[model samples]
Target: MLKLSNETKVGILTVVGITLLVLGFNLLKGKSLFSHNKTIYAVYKNVNGLMPANAVQVNGLVVGSVSNLEVKDKDASQILVTLTITKKIDIPRNSVARISSDLLGTKTVQVDLGNATEYLQSGDTVYAATDGSMTDALKEQLNPLVQKLQGTLSNIDSVLLTVNAILDTTAKGNLQDAIRNLNATMRNFTHTSASLNGMLDPHNGNIQKTFDNLAAVTGNLKDNNQKITGILDNAEKATGALANGNIDKTLQQLQQTANNLNQTIAKLNTTDGTAGLLLNDKKVYNNLQYSLGNLNKLLEDLRINPKRYVHFSLFGKKDKTKPLPSDTAAVQQ
Candidate 1:
C-alpha cells in the first residue's frame, strides 16, 4: 500500500510540472493561455538597432513581437525577421515593415497594411524599409552652418584688425584738427537749430495761419465724408454687379470686339481698304499734297486780285466802284 501511495504522489507532481511548462510556453509566445497566433516574416536591409524580441507595432499599437532574426540568404545584404503576432491582426499581403524609434533609440518594427483587398496568410513575408534617425539628419544640416560661422568669425577678426590699424593711423595724423572742426560744426548746428525753432514757433502768425488752413481742410474733408462713403458704396455695388452678372458673356463680347479691332488694324496695315490705302499707299498722300498746293495757289491769287472774287452792288442798280481820290493820288505819287 505504501509503494502505491508513493507512485500516485509522483504522478500528481509530474502532471503539475507539465501544466506549468505549457503555461510558460504560452506566455513566451505572447499568447493567451488557450489561444493561438500567426507568424509572419519580413526582410530588412540594415537592422542596425533592431534585436530579437523587440515589440512589433501597427499604427503605434503593440501587436506582436519579434521571434527570430537571421541572414535571409547566403548574401548578407538582407536580414530576415520573424514576427509572431496575434491572429486578430489582418496584415495584408502587400504590407510593409519598417524599423522605427522614439527620440531615444528604443526601436520597434512598424507594419503598414497596404491597400490590398486580400489579407496576409501565415508564413507570408512582409516588405521592409529603413528610415534613418533624426540625429544623422540634424548633424548633416548643422555641418554647413558651423563651417559658415567659423569663416564669418575669421573675416570679422581680420576686419577688426584693419579697422584698428586705420584708427591708429588717423589718431597719429590731424585727428585733433578734425575734433576741433567737429566741435565748431556742432556749435553752428545748434545756433541754426535755435533760429529754425524760433521761425517755426507756434505763436508765429504764419504758423498759426498754416495750422488754421490745415484745420479748415480737415473740416472740409470731415463734412464730405458721407459723400465720399456714398461714392465708394456705389462703386462697390457696381463692381459687385459686374462680377455677379454674365461675366463670361461679357468677356466673350470683349473678345469679339478685340478681334474686330485687330481686323481693322490689319486692314489699315494692308493696301486693300480705303483707310488701308490711305495709310499704306503713297497715292493718297501725293493727292493730299497736290490739293494743299492748289489751295495755297488759290489763296495767293485771292490776295493779289481780290476784286475778281469780291463784288458789290447798290440797292437799286449795279454799283460802279472806284478808288478814293486820296488813295489814287497816293498810288500815283
Candidate 2:
C-alpha cells in the first residue's frame, strides 16, 4: 500500500472537485463533456426580452443556448443572434426560429422544424419570425377601438350640447304656454270623456243597442257578401257593355258637339259674322248712338211743344171754326 501525505490527498481532492465543477459547467452550457458545439445564426426583427445564455429549444427540448446578439445592419432593420448548440441536434435548413416565453415568463429561443430534407450546417442562418408580445397585441387591438371611442364620445358631447340648447330654448319660450295648453286640453279631454262615459252608461242601453245593430248589419252584409258580389259583377258587366258601345257613341257625339261649338266660336271671332260684327264693328255702335240722339231730341220737342201736337179743351165754346192747315202742304211749302 502507498502512503499518501495529507497535503497530497487535499490536492487530489481539489483536482477532482475542479474537474467535476468543470464538467457540470459544461453540461449546464448544453454541451457534453467532450462534444463540440455547432454555431448557428438566428435573425430576428425584435429579440423581445431574450438575452445571452438563454436556452434554445426545439419541440420543448433544450438543444442549445443563445451566444450573442448584434445588429447586422442599421439600415437593414435586422438583428443577428448567434447560438451555440449541440451537434447531435439536426436543425433543418428551412427551420424557423423565434423568441418565446415560458409560462413563468422566462423567454427563450425556439426552433420550428420546417419541411426540409436536409439539416442545417454550421454557421447557417435560421430565419426568425417574431411573435407579437401580449402588450403589443393588446395595443394593436385597442388603438383603433380607442380612436372609435374618442369619436363616439365627441359625437355624444355634440348631441348632448344640441339637446341642451334645444331644452334651453324650449324652457325660455313656448314650453310653459305649451304645458298650460296641454293641461287645459287634457282637462277638457277628461271632461269630455266623463260626459261621453255618462252618455254611454250601461243604464242607457243605447250604445249597446247601437253596437248590436251595427254587428247585426255587419253580419247580414257578410252573409250577403257573395250574392252582393255576384250582383255587382253582373251590374258591372252590363255597365261595361253599355259603356263600351253606347257610351262610346255618346262620347263621340259629345266630341262632335264640342268641335261644332269650337267652330262656332271660330266663326264668331271672324270679322264678317254677325256676332263678330257686333263685337268688332264700330259703325253699328255709331248708328245706334245717332238713333238714340235723335230719339232724345224728338222726346225733348214733344215735351216743350205738347200744345202744338195736342189740344185738350174741357169747355166747348167755339167762336170761329178754321180748317187745320194740311200737314203735307205745310211740310212741302
Candidate 3:
C-alpha cells in the first residue's frame, strides 16, 4: 500500500471524525442509519414531556422512537407528533399512540395495536393521547399514604398537647385528689369486708346456731306436714261451715243476746229491776239490817227463858211459880 502525505492523512481523519459526529448526533435523536424507518403522524392535547428519541413500544416492547413534536392548533389545543417505526412492522390503521412516564420521569410512546385487517400506510395520521405526567401519577399513588401520614401527625400532636396539659398544676392536683378518694374508698371497703368477715367467722357460733335452729324447725315442720295439713283441713271445713250461713245465724243470736244484755243493764242502772233496787235502795238495806237485829235479840231471849215461853206435859205436873221482874212490873201496871 502506498502511504499518503500528512495533509492528506489529516484530511481523511477529519472527514472520518466529522462522519462519526454526524452519526452520533443522529443516533442521539433516535435515528438508525442502518435500518429502514417509517413515519406516522398523531395529534394530542398534551405530550406530557414526550421528546424525540423517546422510545416507542408496541405491546411493551421497544419497536421505534418518537421523532418530532409540534403545536398543530393553539386554538383547538391540539399537538401534533411524529413517530418513527421500523418499516418491516405493519401497524393497523386503527392503532392509537399514547405518551407515558416512568419512575424516572423518562417518557415513552405506547401503541395500542388494533384488530383491524387494514394496515396503516407510512406518513398517515394516527390517534394520540398521554397518561397525565410523572408528578400526577406519583400523586395518584401516594395520596392515601400521605393522608394517613397527616392524620397520624395530627394524632401525635393532640397526644403531645394532652401530655402538656396533664403536666399542669391543676391536673396534678386533680390526680392527687382522685388518688385520695380511691384510697378512702379502699379503706371503707376494707372496713366493710372486715365487718362481714366478723359476722361470718366460724368461731362465733351464733350464725351456725341460728342456721341449725332454722334447719331443725324446718325438719319439724316437714315431719308434721300431714298433721298440719289435717288441722288446716279441719279449719278449712269449719270456715266452709261458717261460709254456709251458720256464722250469720250465730252472729244474729249473739247480737240479740247483746241487745238483751244492754236492756237489762239499762234497767238495772235505773233501779227498775230487782237487782237494780237491791243495789240502789238504801231504805231497803236499812230495813234488812233492823230486822236482822230484832231477830237476833228475840233468839237470845228465847235461849235465856225457854221455861216461861214453852210449857210441856203429857201428864200435868206442878206448875212452878217463878216470878221474874217483868212479871211483877206487869202486875203493878
**lDDT winner among the candidates?**
3
Candidate 3, residue 147: lDDT = 99
Per residue, candidate 3 scores C-alpha lDDT tens digits across 26-64 of 888888899888889999887887888899999889988
TM-score of each: 0.42, 0.49, 0.50
Q: lDDT tens digits, residues 1-333, model 1?
A: 445688899999999999999888756745455657788888887886787668889998888888778897766788888888864878888888888777778878889779998987888888888767667667889999999999999999999998788778657466777889999999999999888787678887566778889999999999999999999999999999998999999899999999999998999999998888889889897898799977876776666556657866466454344444444666899
**Lowest-sum lDDT 10-residue window in model 2:** 318-327
How well is each residue in 85-158 modelled by candidate 2, as lDDT tens digits? Answer: 87487887999988887656677888999888898889888888877776777799999999999999999999
lDDT, model 3, position 48: 81
* Root-mean-square deviation (CA) per prediction: 26.9, 13.3, 10.6
Q: What is the lDDT of candidate 1?
A: 0.82
Pairs with backbone N, CA or C atoms under 3 Å apart (clashes), candidate 2 = none
TM-score winner between candidates 2 and 3: 3
